[model samples]
Target: MSSTEHTSLAPVEDDARLPVADPGLGEHVERYTDTDPAAARRAYRQVVTMFGLVPLLAIAFVVVYFAVPQDLWVPLLGTHWPLNNLLLGLTGGLAVLLVGLGAVHWARQLMSDHEMVEERHPATSDAATRAAFAEKVNAGVVDAGVSRRGMLLGSFGGALGILAVPALVTLADMGPWPTAAVRRETIEKTLWTEGEVVVNDVNAKPLRPEDLEIGQLVNAEPASLFDLNGHDYLTEKAKSALIVVRMDPNRIQIPESRRDWQVGGILAYSKICTHVGCPITLWEQQTHHVLCPCHQSTFDLGNSGVVVFGPAARSLPQLPLRVNAEGYLVAQSDFTVPVGPSFFERDSRNDYQEGDQ
Candidate 1:
């Protein structure tokens, strides 16, 4: 066809025989990075630098993991946080942000930005057509112009490689292996000793039987827990928790083995639920049952903290109580049964006589 006979570039001719052809695409506008070589190089360097810092952040996260204690707290946003948590959060957050920013900058400034028009086709494709599509995709990958870029490739690899820092450092939690004796001392026993004073959980005052009336239940912990430093205090607190209850002496049934486990009408039992450890404080005055809110495991305090109802399979461990010369409630001994959830490899010696837990 002659040049004049072809369709116009802008507007269409009114003649139906000389119909206007579709405008394939808009003109490719050159970006500053594409037009200026210096700008492009600067952007590439910036991306590589961002990715390079990822490894340092990852290393810092590892250092913080080992250096900072789990219970260590620092002030931020008006709330105390563990030093480990603060550093890990800062480093991990920055590492992720840098990775995202680097990828974005690389795409915007360094990746080839060319305008191309792909003709639309039907969704389904023949085998030969699919093969052609795959070939074209590989060709596009080559056009990406990153395979030969050593700095960019190395930086990206380093960022991804050090991503395992958080995962590896978290494995520390599975460690600090508790030897059988350590396990017995830490998880099974609390700060309660033969004469350790029972203190009010709320006011920290020494508890006496007089402080409670019939059908009254008060949360109590051993006085020795107050002396422990930070993490030790928390661990002891979890196991040392006690619930002191006063009932009519006639209503309380004392086993032959546990005859002297109460002082006056006050009896104490571990606040931790045997089924699944939840700090159980929900008491039933009428039924004399203490309910675990977590799984609704009910233990009858009137009995030997026997599982009276719900999902509980084991009886709550009772702490032997005595009145010291000061007329205050005190522990006769540590809990005879292991406390908290019945984990595997626990002190089997303390299992319930009633049945398997």
Candidate 2:
């Protein structure tokens, strides 16, 4: 069509509404870094320096791990510390943390800052429209000016490079090998060694077989806790804690091999819960069940301290008991198996070795 004919054919003002005028983008404001290239460069250098230092800190973490002996002590706040682990952890953590800070600073101070407009479109588009969108994204990158910012790019790269240091250092920190220190010292043994007298928790008095009545449940601990020498008060109390429960001898189901393990009708069990290691005292006298309040785990005192309910997967650990030369209640031996929750590498077969015996 001719231009004049096309103009004549176009809708007049009365037939069609005029399109809304574009408001255009907001007015651009120059940041301090934008106006001062020297200041921008300084900021970029500071970020790069932080990233560069991160790898050094990470290397220091590794050196501390190997060079510093685990048992060596350093005086701090009037207390001696085995500083190898602490120093390694701090240096490794700081290495990764500094890299993150450096990257954030580089992006905020030296990277490009601009605004652009994008026209909205329908959700579904044809193949040609999608290809055009990809080109627009590439154009957006040019507008962002990333390729022109050499200092910012360098700082970003350095920051990313340093982040690997902490990752490698942390792997070493995880372990040389698994340590069973806590299990061996705490769970496998208690205050109830052979010949240690059993003392009532309430009155701190030594108990005889006659002191307990049928269906009576008493909290007890090793007699060593009363002594001033040969043991620390806290350590003895933690390792030797126990609960003494007396029931009808006929109603008790003592294992065949453990028949003489109890003194009269009184049986002793570890106070530590088999669930999550809380001290369990909540008891049901009629059912001979002791319950843990922390997670509601219940154990049957009359049936080898077996777990009868709740989240506990194992029974409460049993302590062997006997009478001393003076006819007072005493421990026959320490707990045979580990107390508290089951661990990943726990020797279950060894634990159950004498179940039928």
Candidate 3:
């Protein structure tokens, strides 16, 4: 036969079978609990015991959550144990697992175990069949004796209640907002002032204009950072940071109003990244660009620290600098504008009216 005839003949033979065998089902085995009251009662007690333990484990989980400090660690074998995390996770996980296991065990061993075979039927059941299904469900619920088992009901409810404690405890860290002192002294101001000396970050020496060569860039900080009190040390160190770069005067594009802001070829700009406030010092001598290592933000130092590339939204802040009568580099005044990342008030019309100078 040709391939087309053979293919057509194969389908015809397959279609010739009008009926298929119905395997029906095999014999169902009766469980011990089905015939014996004592065995059924024992299974009931075992399921109840597992459910009862869940509430106790949940309570232990709450206790561990509150009592353990977050930083506490214990060495076990060669691996370090985050004991607090380990204990809390294990107790809470076991409580939930036990509750599931108890429910499954009770359904299999103690509740109704009659084997049922549901024959294929039409898509929609008639009213009589629907009523019979509801009746069977109600009968199963009655046989389970869930309403009469006060201990199981109470223990399961308690376990669910105790699980909410960890969520409440975590909400405590949300805060009442920054303290007034922190808001005013740290966030709003920095160590830079009229006479604060600008010191080289590397050797911590005072900077002189003569010390900087053409096309040189130096990471710098305020002298007051070394003597800060309490949290001021970190606060001042973060905001008062500066980057000193020198280029030929002819290569620079200084605004007419900022002509006196630089001493010789040396200019200073805030080292804080405008993108997200990382301390930036990476420099490219030929391009006169200072790059932030965090997100590769590039700023052209010869053009008032203009952002040349990457994600930074604004230019790096320029710090007005001059030589004191004694020849040490000092800030001309506090930054005219706030020095870090942009905020809601920063771009408001009222803030821009104040101007960068």
TM-score of each: 0.82, 0.65, 0.62
Residue lDDT tens for model 1, 1-357: 876787657765566645766666888899998899899888988999999999999888888888888877778799887787788889999999999999888888887787787778899999999999899888766655567566887788789888887778788778568788877766777787889999998888999778899999999988877878787878889988999999888887777677788876689998998877898999989889899999999998888888878876778888999999999988887888787777777755655444333
Task: In candidate 3, list every pair of residues with a backbone clash.
Answer: none
Candidate-wise lDDT, in order: 0.83, 0.78, 0.78
Better of 2 and 3 by lDDT: 3
| Global Cα RMSD, each model | 8.6, 9.5, 6.2
> Tens digit of lDDT per residue, candidate 3, span 1-357?
766664434554543674666657778888898889899788778777887777688778778878887667889899888898889888888888887887777788766666678978998989999999999999987766676555655665665676676667657667545565554554557778898899987677999999899988888998878876655677778888898988998987787767888998789999898788988878888889988898999888888887779998788778889999889999998765667776644532322111233
Per residue, candidate 2 scores C-alpha lDDT tens digits across 1-357 of 866664436656842565666568979988788899898778767876887777688678778877888867789889886798679768877877887888677667765676668789899999999999899888766644457755555655665676675577568655445457756765566667889899987678999999899988889988778774432676566656788999988887888877888878799998888788888899788888999999999888888887778998877788888898999998888888887677786776644322556
Q: What's the lDDT for residue 155 in model 3?
A: 62
Better of 1 and 3 by TM-score: 1
Q: Which ten residues in a row have the lowest lDDT in candidate 2?
A: 348-357
lDDT for model 3, on a 0 to 1 scale?
Answer: 0.78
